[model samples]
Target: MIPGRDFPGKTALVLLTSLAVVISPALAFAHTGESGLVLLLPTDYYLLGGTLAVLASFCLIFLWPAARLERLCAASLPIGSLRVPSQTAISAIACLFLTALILSGLFGSRDPRSNPLPVTIWSVWWGSFVFVQAACGDLWYYLNPSIAPSRLVRSLLRRPAALLRYPGWLGHWPAILSFGFFSWLELVDLAPDDPTRLARFVLLYLGVTIAGMVLFGEDIWLARGDPFSFFLRLLAHLSPIDPRPMPADPARRRLFLVLPGSRLFHLPALTLSGTLFVLMTLSSVSFDGLSRTFRWLSLAGINPLEFPGRSAVLAFNTTGLFGVWLVVAAAYLGVIALGQLINPTWRLVRAAGLLVISIVPIALAYHFAHYLTILLMELQYVVQIYGDPLDRGWNPLGLQPNFVTASFLNDYHAVSIIWNLQAGAVVLGHLVAVAVAHVLNARLGGTGWRAVVAQVPLAILMVLYTLFGLWLLAAPNIG
Candidate 1:
């Protein structure tokens, strides 16, 4: 253990008690997934420090003047340039890859882990690639499968414009709905990881995206209608690598190493729909964590140990998914309203649009914390599949079925390391969120003290959320 300082007696005791209350039905945490070792831990002790760290970060921000912070965020070093290949070529390759995965799903092994499609979608795409996007910048721009097909059709017809103009009033509601349905497919659906079912769903998604692109322009549809591309674009804003098209050659982009989240400094207030989109992103991830908890299963009248499969609670979990999102949406809007009460000049909705970007780091943190174990376990299967593209058991790599090992998860010491790593990520993410929120408030133009005062409510909410995030880590999980 990396020992530092322990929380004082009463404070530590109280936090432990709070953790108990939040995670009732004790020992529920130790039987499932990679979190089994968490039951005997001093998890609440970790939570106390995480909560304090978030509060300290919030307080520390008041010391730095807005200009100094802006300068800090804007600091960067040039990293030369790279010329991108034609989008049509890049997208065609991506499209071919997608087609191969779909074929593999249709004809390969029935096992979800062995199947290339499910492993790639659940483990590779959502698990690892997302973090890559947050580290590097918008690489997905060159890899969208829908773009190549749409562009090829447009060129063949000798018309750059689409069949119809995208409506201005529509906003990002289409993207919001796309994401909402996808969350359901990922979380509540009984056989989301089933190869054949997932392949069909992907086909449906491709058809819709292509039709929308052909009718209403690739750029607009991708930016406003497709869920994966738009969400990745949002994540790209937090990357340190800043890529901008070269003035002399549009094909090449100049890259600079700026501070992470620095791009957010220049982003204008989002539309009302855009704000909801951000909120929904956070809410759906939260629900994903919540739905898997022992507490949630108990509430739905399912025994944690006996654990009826997903088929039994499909309807109940489906409603719970939407219920969690609606509750989060309501609470977020209300918090913004409370903040607006302190500063009457700003309208309720616009104020939310301005500050919502600050939540991006928190959302990304949740993504990492919630899915890290899955990535660790499933990535082994991915490497195995490299040798057996169709899972035909060719034995070229001489890999045994034991290649997908869960031994580390069963060991207490290894599990502790994993848990601590997850805790650290959750804490650091909140600290960055506090800083981002402070910088954004400073952009509103006020004296130092006034700027600090304006963000007090937000800071408090962040602290509470920090506690919640920690609790989610130590909470009893269902699977």
Candidate 2:
């Protein structure tokens, strides 16, 4: 779709490089009866077929209706001033609650003989990677679970006045300070295994988040100008919808409210984000559940816990996590939707669509890079263990007994080959996305191709460094 770009050539090069690194090794090692890991599974074939079928059905059901709805909205809504509410207090409370829950889970003793110090701290440290983004994008405001209900209650209390009143300033520096402090703790590994240290860290984060929201004002921080806001603005370009212009007039605006729809279906941003949140939670739960199931299944005729009960509990917890993630995602969408409501003429749908599309490449690259790095780094350890034939001692760090039963050297080689292939795919995916973005920009009169070209090297280097850091973590080492 991008003009002047040779997709075939780029794709061919990717394939060739992948083969040289992944497939060639397999062929050479074939004589030794060793096979390299293959990324694609037979199950993938069935999954792909099912996906196509579902997509076709969806198109048949909704494509025309969705188009008509879009046209109607485009014609009806008028442009007007935008007014997004402040969410400082709500966001602060959310940060506190979430931090408390995670800390409790991490530090609280689960078994009588088990110590809660090091493991809990390590868990929190790992969690830091996932929660850091909240500090980056005024994400606390969006992720806070209390916001919606609080706003509704406030509205009920105030009646007419609530309609126009925006959330007041709580503070901003507190959040920044909190983020910096936590980042320091994680980076320095200060008191790395101490529960007290982790508790202190959590307290500091909560204190800062709360203090900042109280001092600076959430609405002002969320508006354009701040670095986080700026990045979000740039990311917004990927969205198919626009949130800048207000709707044309009151009558047109009323139509959106009058339309009868499922709550999930009505909120496009919420639906998209919520779906992803659910999928991630489900995948994690399913992976763990299936693993437990297999372990039990292997025991000859010994039925452990009821499989149905175990599955039900897993499902419940998975659903709960999904709900929590959905709440956070919905809060984010709510903020943007408010912006759209303020300016009705804004094409929110198209902007949302584009943003969703743009994120795909980045998400894929992140996942592939993470898993590949893990596989590669682990392979090195496996090789060391297997290459030493005289060593019969258990390798706690090696994957032989833990991952799969095979010659340590052969298993490591297979994993390494797969990792290399995945890494190549990750790199290729990102480069292609950048190029595609540039091409799309040109077509849309956005940034020039030269700008994208200038940044490619830097982007690649950054990706490499990130992957390397992750690889270091993936290797077996005591926290």
TM-score of each: 0.88, 0.34
Number of the top TM-score candidate: 1
lDDT string, candidate 1, 1-479, tens digits: 00122334564354345433433322222112345344455876566655555555665665566555665566676778888778779889999999999988888777886788998888889889999999988889888888888887888888789899999999988999988888899988988889999998888899899988988998889888898888899899989888877789988988887767878777777778888888888878877777777888888889888887988889988898888778867777787777766666546677777788888888887788778777877767888877678666666777666454555666667767666566555555655566677677765555534455767777777667666655665787866
Error of 1 at 63 (Å): 3.1
> Candidate 2's C-alpha lDDT?
0.34
Question: Which run of 10 residues does model 2 get worst, by summed lDDT?
Answer: 255-264
lDDT (tens digit, per residue) of candidate 2 on 22-93: 323221111000123433434444234323332332222222233232222232122233344456565546
For candidate 2, give the lDDT of residue 83.
46
Model 1 alpha-carbon drift over 4 Å, by segment: 1-33, 39-46, 404-413, 445-450
- Model 1 RMSD, rounded to 1 decimal: 7.5
**In model 2, where do residues sit more than 4 Å from their true spots?**
1-180, 219-414, 417-425, 436-479
